[model samples]
Target: MKTLLLLLFLLLLPIKTYSAVIEKIEIIGLKWTKEKFVRRELLFKEGDNFSKEKLKNSIRNLLNTHLFYKITPEVKEKDGKVTVVLKTKERFPIVPIPKFRAKTNRAFKTGIEIRDYNFRGMGNHIFLGLTKWFKNEHSERNFYINSMFYRIIKDRIDVGITLNFFNSYNNVFTKDNKVLGNYDLKSFKANVYMIEYLDLEKIRRLMLSFRPEINKYSNWIESTNQYYLSLGFTVDKTTDMVYYTEGSFYSFYIDFAEPNLSTVFTGSLIGTYSNSLKRGNINTLSFGGSVGTKIGYSGNGFLLDSGIPGYVSDKVKGKRFFNFKIFYRLALINKTVFIKPTIAGGDAFSNIPDNFLISPGFEVEAFWARLVDGIIRFKIFKGIGSGSDVQTSLKLGFRW
Candidate 1:
């Protein structure tokens, strides 16, 4: 009986094995196009025994490119083998040039600046800023003042105040508006930084200074907003004020201020850029421009005074400035210094705003101590079209 059963089992085993042989497999549905991005080839060889595990792996590899928004793989079998097909949707990659953002050491300690990423990823491009400075060498010698804020919605706010300082007045006006200006108890300022976002792929930002220097005028009572645009980095308030646009990979700005009753006509453009090279050296370029009238008073109006003589006065009577800069950010003994050669068109101004007038100068930022930074700059300005010339002036300041 045992021998008869063994013979039957052998006969049945051969029949079952033959039934398991795959005849054909079909694969279909691919997600990516043949152009632009190349797809990986199928790993399974023709006429080979199909393994489900091997087919599944091939589908997974294709999806890892991150270029696909969706991926689906299907397999079909006929007679003896199985075929696999992948259906995929390709995704476009959007590259973002990140901004190396920073804030004052005091801001970090006070927790005044709060955010996760320095470079916001919501819109195609955006810019935001907040800065405040205060100096209290001793209780007897107290000087407090310096603050500005620029944002692109849901970004940040900056406020500043000073107790002892030079006295300055702000005059306000508008189209069909009356002239009004005022002197602050000490020229203290406080403002909200609002940033506007556009659908453009390039960075856009605006900062407003609502210091109530023009108390008599209604428009001056509320702060006015200024715009700045750029492709990458920015550092310094003056650049944002005068030359708002220039440079290839740095900061850029555009300002639109009104004259009387919201009659916005005054505008300015500026930009700046810098690069780091081998041997602890750096290269930088900065330039900016604007075209407008030197009307009555307003924020930053002191700058618009072209200082040009007259019609043939060898000077344009509006605000105009241009600057070319090459600088290096160097490190020595655990400290850094930014040294640059600068050529400016309107460094203090002559009679006419022209290419003829040129000021050649150099600026230095020395980091002597970990907490002490010093800045000194000098320029020799010569007038163009005319022979008017001015002596070089030196600026000295300390930063903590």
Candidate 2:
């Protein structure tokens, strides 16, 4: 009896002494991405206790990067030590976009752009593009250099900057459906922004930005130099795969400009929020609202763009606006393609419940999985109450 008891004690002791410690981590199938970049997204490192939740979170973070085509996780445990292996298949990183359009007596523009999402195996982005506009058989060229993100410290902080040179022409119109005036603008602008991620993924964060511009206007106004600063905070809890399928997002930003320099505004505030849910593969529903107010604003370029199908942004005008919107999308082709429909009602005035705008519209989206910018979209919309019009357009790229 004593000998039998001793053997049972030995087996129980081994079980009691075992601990699920991470002994090693191995990342595979990386050619352009660095191992450190993958490690940064992980919630645990070597010699740490194992957690299934953290492993799942790390996978979520990686998927949100949109840097991989497929990811498979493998785990092995022996004598309570765990070894994890993550094998990944990367997507094509280099993306190019070419645009062309020509319509008589309308504003049509063209551009060519190239972007690199991952620069030098580091998680950085850079873009170079050129745009040209045609007016009365003459072409105006625009030059720009944009850097989307550059990590400078602690992996969570980033900076972005842009330099743009342009010769632009635009027509100003009044509410009476008549042309007010036209202006030619020769301008140079510089923009810089910084972002700090509160989580491993930038789905929630804080943002600060500055834009300084110099404009040389032809006969409409004098040349001027002006700048503004914007600060915003966002809180988001969304699961991203192919696209953000469900969850909630809330954000607000305030803008401040030089006093009496450009009348862009002394200060302005905007806030918005949305919550979404997925109902099987049938559809995803999202609802949200936004409010805006401008201090010392001209209210001339007022726009109400809710991504609702039947309205153009510039047709609405106001000094302050508040609106509510509902959005829906039907999933097809494994959620790679979507049928999006939207409805919104509100006005850019004090009376929110009376005589507001109601817009309803829908669009079809298709994507090619091989290319980064392979999304194509067709949209149609109609509005009731205000800015009512029938509009349809087709576009290529991922802007929507």
Candidate 3:
């Protein structure tokens, strides 16, 4: 009787195994999301292995879109087939954010930006904003609209289009720490770029960009219109969570401009590395630096840094910035409530080091998040050099 039972079990094993294979996938609560958009990020589809590990990975990929606040997946097994269902709680993708930034006794900018991270549920981003720059007496207003990240072809191609009309009152100071004057800077620009995503992970890409720009001195009668072409390559493998981030990123680019194509060339390299230990009291640490030079274009505003506090913002030829930061958990509300005493030095910007206007300051950062993954940061930073101010900035990080 034991041998007969064993024989019957062996014969049924293949039938049971086939029943475990995925036969269908169903998505729930994605009313605004296109099914293909979610499917492209999945690890398995119909007639494929439906392992728990693969389902978890698929959910992880879905989270990366930032479209949903939470995704709960269910795997159902019938007599002979497996069906997977993903129940997602979609976030309110359209958000209007108010912005404020300033240094002590310095100028400030106040604005409102409306961002749609999941435009039409296509996993694209679009934003338009207007800001007023306030100085002691002089002020200027700026407006911008951009679709800086749009996925065109599934896992293959992307595009960016942007327009900016900006007028700035840049405060110029004298060696005696007195207000020498302010430079009235006016400019308009439009950019269109395309990116070819090279791999399945979408972390590596080759980009081609075209930009037409107009730069001028409002006080002085100087203006120029230049067209530029650029090519760049990037590798970004980063994962970001509420309290921690882990990844490595690197990029390189070279540009050529038409006004002085022979001499007007520039190249840049930027990269960063971050790692976290989620098992202990300690949490995260990150460090990165960037250096770049322009072969020509030594005119005003070429470099947006003057190395002088409270001076005109754009007076440098190229860019240089670096930072070292560490994050420790203060409390646990959801995942982690706050990053207390989050300390960073060098380029004070968080996450991506895209800002190269180096103030060389140390940052005291405290931040809190919301249920839908919203973050508000209170940053108190002091400049390292002489004539530096005790700057205070309030930033709302839209986790779209």
Candidate 4:
């Protein structure tokens, strides 16, 4: 009786294990981007077992590339075999964009940039622009050029390279808003990075980067040349790179500056948590902070204008500093529009005032979901210090 039962169990196992296998992958829609590029983004291939989750993630990965306007995946099963069909609509490769920004009590800048998103149909990008700024009854100009190239190998290793160049004349200011000098600056920067996807869960990514930069600054007072080598590592578990509704990101880097300038170590942490409130409304809380210290003799440290609103870069210079900000965002229109209020405070430990600074600000933002996948933000800030004032800014930029 035992032998008969074993034979029956073995026979049923074959029937239960019979599942549909992917027979063919048909990609419909390729005007500029190649079929190989599209296939490389997919998570599954022919002869693999069909999974609905992988198919969904494959569509998401393709959309994340920002090259497609529309994507639809269809699975058809016939005679125990499955076929996957992907339909996509490509975006216009070349876009001529006009950029403008206005900051209260600071500068107003405008420029026209022409960007090619799908360079040679290989998911590369290149842009060139010329910008002019008007500030304090003086005019400054800058020329910018940038290029980014991305490649994926074996569905795991993600490689990218960025080249950037800038030439400009910038006004140097002291911490008390006094004009120190003006510098004619020319800089060239290049970065090479690789991201290794650890597993199919997509829960963790390891990032490694190396950047080399050279800057030449000339002024009536003196002339200086600075060279820097930066190495970075980051472990990211964030679900979204653009709109961070949840998860955390952490990064650490070390910079070595030549000519006895400064050797600095910096680290940052950012976290976001979201909850569903009443009536389909969502509330998100985000916090980010960074700390930096100089290891050697600090000649002149860079500005710490980030992590705190309402503070201009020219008014803040430090060698060792710590800054943090907390933000609360309420989705007013199903996450398409948000009312965000933030409170930020930070302190410099060296080379500046040793007092902590605080700023309270609010912003109204609209997310362009269909057209460009960007955000338009209008913000107002009030700084509470020994003697400070209110500032406002208008920003039009990409998300994340």
Candidate 5:
């Protein structure tokens, strides 16, 4: 029958000409070294067109350039012309030192903390801390101070300053409703940060903050001062989430604050989502949310006069308030070493133009922050609350 139908059309024409010869090859430019590849032009040329998903996306864009430490992509085909090669391995960057530990009987108790991170890479960081607190009931002792500063311009400006005293006694509204006394909370903060890198890993961060606060409630009341200014924005995205597990992250942030004594000016929104799953050792699931609003213009009053007892000092003029929150996080040794547990809740509603009031609460946390290899961290924070103003706290600190 006509030579077996021409042998099935010559066997489907070589599988449709090898799937159309894979149109265009990929892997254009990627670099790091030789002076950031000629000041970031990243070397890769020639009328490019070779496929295999563009050589695995140029080997994930040269290992996301954290200064690379091994990344190789090689492909060569003769007679038809196709050659793409990129091999890089280099790493040496360090700035890590700031460690901490803490305890309290009503205030201050800390051990092992040394801060200094040798800078000069167009980025600088500094920290100095010393603490000890407990003034009565036999443990008699009091001395405190802490500081921090960070500056950078490599990827676009970031400046900061942080100072805290006595660390706010684990801060639950800075102590009042009968909490064993010996209170002191002083804070000064200034921050400006902006970062953009929407490719090769993705990132965007923006922040502007100013905080000045003072609260002293020692023998039980009257010692308050407050001022706050804030603006923030953040968006982060990362991919590659399958087996080796070192990816999958998402974040969102929004904030606005203006408080010189409370008549309301705090709008906030925060969100975070994380995912990771692996059997022989990796697991993570995180989700978080927050919403808050308190809008009023003048009538400044009620900024901590030993609050929480029949709250409503009346100068809240055009009043309005609202809050909402949700949280879930569980990560156990998720790669290096990590353990986080959080369950949160929130409810606060108050209005005057048409009267409304609601207050609800619940929060719990078990924390751990680390990186001792770099020099410090083993942080801790414990919190608990069921409802109707019953709060608790325990915190240990360290950050670098």
Candidate 6:
């Protein structure tokens, strides 16, 4: 009986545990966002093991949303347990934006856009925009509505919808830089897209989209209806979403359209890389190219635009093109203001001038969370081949 009692006592001895368990989680500085939304983005939960890597990734995920201007994490240990604390400063979510641009010997365009980054305290985004172009008595107008919704699931699926209407009286140019004629175009379109997070490390997404559109042209042009389908993929590893200072981004997409029951195909690829230098300076480089071709009786094509600084999109019309750009920015005024000088050039081939184009430009941008964000830019571009001309452009925009 004594031996049996001693064996039972030895078996009942307490075992020691070494892993630190989370005791509590504290979140501070929330003005418009819900606590659950912030907690949903976290990688660690109560009673989970304390992991520094998970905490760092949680902070990065929160910052990528652009919902906070500052985020800090703190850990406290007591009685063999740990407490995690998060401190955040929220950004102003609503913005009323105005934009204006003009080019040498080209029509001036002006527009206004309103965006709500945080709609109804959720992570949804909504935007309404209008644009107008003035060229003598010929004017053009465009209106659009865009919205995005995110599901609160583990995979975090996102859906977006867009509506657009446009009416334009455009002047056409010839190969020798002469005005060919003016035509009136009217169009309306509706688009729906869904993005699925592929449960990959650090933000990889896939998108599927469908669009239906109708267009009418004046002066004995045929009116038509079209349907489009698209597939897209993106890999974003950027450290800072608002002001990208490091990491890389890559995206590729292909689109198919049935215009008047004829099949057309288009595809594009784009990439960007950014790095932060010492003393608060940043450098960024980007390059992109697109190809569009018609099959059989398809009439749709691709056009290059001033989408790239110093290059005019309307100046080139082609079935395929490529472009490259380099930008370096100097930090000034507490890192909130930046002076960026850039150089970009590209050429269009197949149905357009096969000449190389070069453009050099500079930009001034100021970003402040307290007041407003604004930018002023100027660029000068020269074409090196046929149908090329030296052009200058100015642009201004404000958001708050």
RMSD of 1: 19.7
* Candidate closest to the true structure, highest TM-score: 2
lDDT of each structure? 0.36, 0.75, 0.64, 0.67, 0.39, 0.68
* Cα distance off (Å), candidate 3, residue 14: 18
Better of 3 and 6 by TM-score: 6
Best-first order by TM-score: 2, 6, 4, 3, 1, 5
lDDT of 2 by residue, 50-123 (tens): 88888988987776666776779999999989999999877677788887776878857788888787787666
Pick the lDDT winner: 2
- Listing every candidate in turn, what is its Cα RMSD in Å to the true structure after a full C-alpha superposition? 19.7, 5.3, 7.2, 5.3, 20.0, 6.5
Error of 5 at 32 (Å): 19
The sequence of per-residue lDDT tens digits that candidate 3 reaches over residues 1-400 is 9999999999878664433789889988876678989988887889986688778667766766667667888878987679998987776777787877774889887898888777878878788999986774557788999895556755668888999998766646354777655567788999999999786556788999999999886554457778878888888676544345456667777776666333555433344444444545435445444444444454423332223222133322235445455555444454544444444444322234544333433333333322333576555545444334556555665444
Q: All candidates' TM-scores? A: 0.35, 0.84, 0.72, 0.73, 0.25, 0.77
Better by TM-score, candidate 2 or 1: 2
Question: Model 6: runs farther than 4 Å from truth?
Answer: 1-18, 99-111, 131-139, 152-155, 168-185, 200-202, 241-244, 261-300, 303-317, 351-354, 370-400
Model 4 CA deviation exceeding 4 Å by range: 1-18, 29-32, 89-93, 101-108, 133-139, 152-222, 240-247, 262-288, 296-300, 303-306, 311-324, 331-336, 350-358, 387-389
Using lDDT as the yardstick, the better of models 1 and 3 is 3
Error of 1 at 189 (Å): 5.7
Ten-residue stretch with the least lDDT total in model 4: 268-277
**Steric clashes per prediction:** 43, 3, 2, 0, 3, 3
Of 3 and 5, the candidate ahead on lDDT is 3
**How much RMSD separates candidate 5 from the native structure?**
20.0
The Cα error of candidate 6 at residue 132, in Å, is: 5.0
